[model samples]
Target: MTDTIIIGAGPYGLSLAAHLKAAGIDHQIIGEPMGAWRHYMPPGMMLRSEAFASSLQAPRSGFTVEDYCRLKGLAYSALGMALPLETFVDYGLWFQANLVGETQQADVLSLRRVDDEFQLLLTDGRALTARKVVIALGLKGFAQTPPPLQGLPARYASHSERYGNLEWASGKDIAIVGGGQSALGLSALLHELGARAHVLMREDLVVWHERPQGGRRLLARLKTPDAGLGRGWRSLFLSECPGLFHRLDPARRRLIMDHSYGASGAWWLHDRVVDKVRISHRTVVNSAAIENERVVLDVLSDGRQERVSADHVIAATGFRTDMRQHAFLSRELAEALSTQGGMPELNSHYETRVSGLYVIGPASAHSFGPVMRFVYGTKHASPTVARHLSGSLKADARQRAPARRPRAAAGASR
Candidate 1:
């Protein structure tokens, strides 16, 4: 049995593994290296975050996005320059090579807490036990499509993560639903692909993110500090200190989390979206169904109801921390979890109510705050979890060891 098992090899998993290995912890990471980045995210897309914030945390400081770019002899920018999706994937692979090495590419069929250790069933028809398990599964199986489009078949509508290339929708009428970055990005991409596309947003006006500038004054920087979530005192606090959020009352925590991170298009996407793709604001999809070999959307917008017929519908509704949807956890284990709004209730050490079972990445956002959803959170989270685990393991070892006897009768006269 391994001392610890990491279920996913994304940024959080790799980061925690790096720390654990350096601390001499017995652990194994299983999953595709950079799997989500390569599979979920489409090509030609650039990260919304700045270069410095998109890196996986290492024990040392040399392995950053900027560092990767420099080593590759590519153009480097620490500020909010466009880091292509491919570049980030390659960097993640490189990080895996240098830090954690190749991960075991096996699917975890189910994870069950059997007494003290976890029984992990693997796709390769093997079962393994581990003292602890870390579910570092990033944004996989969490793409949510709205109710209206949920029932439609795959040929008609799909989530943004379902497609890697939009060329399949060429010569087709496509409708993208959402006002967020994904929606906007896909709209632009579809327009470039020579597809007829329209973006439907519930908001009247889309809030385009302002381009991040360099050489800011000290006062300005102090007021709205740079962070993964963007420039703001609240953002700065959440990014720098995630634990404080976990200490807040549940209601307050939920409120803050829900309100934070309003989504919009990248500043660079302004030109591509404007005058290129049609955007229908104040639009809400009431219902969707397959009609006449296509999907028909009954939408309400601007106090009027209208029918939108399209060859395909792309949903960019985003994800939630709903634990009930996690199919990997056994029924008994899933029922045992103490959750807050489907998010696992976690302690400061990222441990759930069940001892030795931990969760990081987006799953821990409710505990650690909005920053937990971003790759940047790994810097703080991985080290914190590693230190706690390492200390706990050593303490356990000490407890199990036979105590040494004191020198017999050193002071007694024989």
Candidate 2:
């Protein structure tokens, strides 16, 4: 049996695997490297995060996005530059190749606890056992569709997370539901791809992040320091002090999360979206129906009902983190998890209530803080988890080892 198995090859999984490998821990990582980014995101889409915030964590330095940029001679900046999706994916792959290599490209069909170990059934018909398992499955199987847009065929509707290319909607009328980054970004891409794209949102106004400033004066930097989340005292606290965030009462923690970050387009997206795409604010889709091979949305806006017809509707609604949604998890295991708002409760080291089971990445955001939702959060998660697992695994090994007999005193006994 392996000491541990990580079930994803995304940023978080790969980073943690790198740390575990450095710590001389016996583990296996499985999944497609940069799977979601390579398959789901649109071709020309840019990352919402700035350059410095997008690095995958490792045990050592010289593996950052900045390091990759320097090695490749690519233009680099901490902010004020939009990172292309291709560049970020390439960087992740590079990290995987150089640090976390030979990941098993297989899917876990089922996961259940057996006696004292966890058994994993793989798509390749291989069964594996491990003392510990880490679920790093990023955002997969958690797409949330608004109730109004449910039960529509793929031809009529699709979630934003399913798109790797927007060319199929060229010259078609598309109504995107939501005002967040996904909606605005998709609208921009769809419009630029020759599709008539419009945004529908429940908010009266669309919020846009102000452009980030670089090379500020020392006093200005001290006043508002740049952080992994963003620039501000609150952002600094959330970005750096996830442990503290986790200690607050659950209700207060949720309150902080609710008010901390709302839907807003990236600074670069504002110029591409505003005035370029039609946005219907204070709008909610009441129902959707397909007529004559076209999707029609019955929407409420400003207390008035209206019918908006589009060739297809795209739901930009984000993901929901329900552990039960992971079908691979057995019913018993799912029910055993103590959760808050469908998120698994995690200890300080990111372990679940079930011993030897851990979660990282966006799935841990509820317990760790909003930082856990971003790639930047790997900085804290990777080493923290590696240290805990390494120490615990070693202790377990010592306990399992056979005890030595008392040595004969000065060769008196043979």
Candidate 3:
């Protein structure tokens, strides 16, 4: 059996695999490299994360986004620069190739515990067993579509995460819900593609992040230090202190999750969306129906209801973590795992209640904090989990090793 198997070869999986490989752990990392960024996100979209914060974590140097840019002779800055989605995806692939090595592209058909080992069935009718499993499946199987927009036919409605290309949406009337980066950014891309995009948000006002200043003096820097999440003390703490976040009362943690990062657009997206895309504040879709083969929305804004029609409705409603949503998990394994607010309850090592089963990436956010939702969190997650797995694997090896027989007195043993 392999020492470990890491599912999902995105930033989280690739990052952790790099650490495990460096430690000489016998393991396999599977799934398409940079799958979500390459297949789910719309082309031409700019990443909300600044250039510096977008690197994949690894124990070795010369593998960060900045390093990749320098090697490619592309212009780069730690702040104030908008990282293109294509560039970030390319960086992830490069990181995988240079550090994590080959990743199995096969899909995991199912995963279940078989006695002491975890059994995984792959797409090619192949079965692999491992002592440990890490689910780093990024944001897959977690797209959250609001109730009113749910159950609509595919022709009339879909989630924003389902789109990797916007060409088909050109010249179409599109209605989007939510006020966050996804909604606003997709609106900007759709508008630029000649689509009439209207954004309906429940918030009375849209929030836009301030452009990152190039340089700040000591006092300003001290007051609001820069971190992977953003430029503020709170952001810094959340970015660097997931352990502390986990130690807080569950209710307080939930409060932070709800209010910490409300819907907002990136600084660069503000110009592209404002005065270009039509956005209605304090508006929400009450119901949706097909009228004349078009999606009709009963939208409520400022306490007044209005009828809205569109060729398609997109829910940029973001994701919700629930371990049960992963279909590959066996019924027995699913029931064996514990959850908190739909998230897998993880320990300090990112292990679940099921021994040898662990979850990382966005799914670990509830246990680790909001940082796990972003690539920068891999800096903490990869090394931390790798250290724990390394020690555990070593102890297992010692137990399996044949004990040496006591040496008999010189020449006494036959």
On TM-score, who's better, 1 or 3? 3
Candidate 2, residue 364: the lDDT equals 86
What do the candidate models score in CA lDDT, each in turn? Answer: 0.86, 0.91, 0.91
Candidate 3 root-mean-square deviation in Å: 1.4
TM-score of 1: 0.95
lDDT of 2 by residue, 69-137 (tens): 999999999988899999999999999999988899999999999987999999999999999999999
Candidate 2's error at 353, in angstroms?
A: 0.2
Ranking by lDDT: 2, 3, 1
Error of 1 at 237 (Å): 0.7
Q: Tens digits of per-residue lDDT for model 3 on 1-414?
A: 899999999899999999999999999998999998899899889888788888999898999999999999999999999999999999998898888899899999999998889999999888999999999999898999999888999988999877888899999999999889999999999999999999999898889999998689999999999888899999999999998888888888888888877799999998899999999999988999999989999988879989999999999999998778889999988877746656788888999999889999999887888899999899899998999999998898898899999888997958
Clashes in each model (backbone N, CA, C under 3 Å)? 0, 0, 0
Candidate 3 displacement at residue 204 in angstroms: 0.7
lDDT of 1 by residue, 1-414 (tens): 898999999999999998888888999999998887887777788888788789999988788998999999989777758788899999989988998876789989999887768899889888889988898987777778898787688888888876686678778899999999889988888888889998989988989888898789999998888888788888888898888888898888889988988668888899899989999999999999888898889999778999998999989888877766779898877876746666798889999888888889998988889898889999889999998898877887787799999776877865
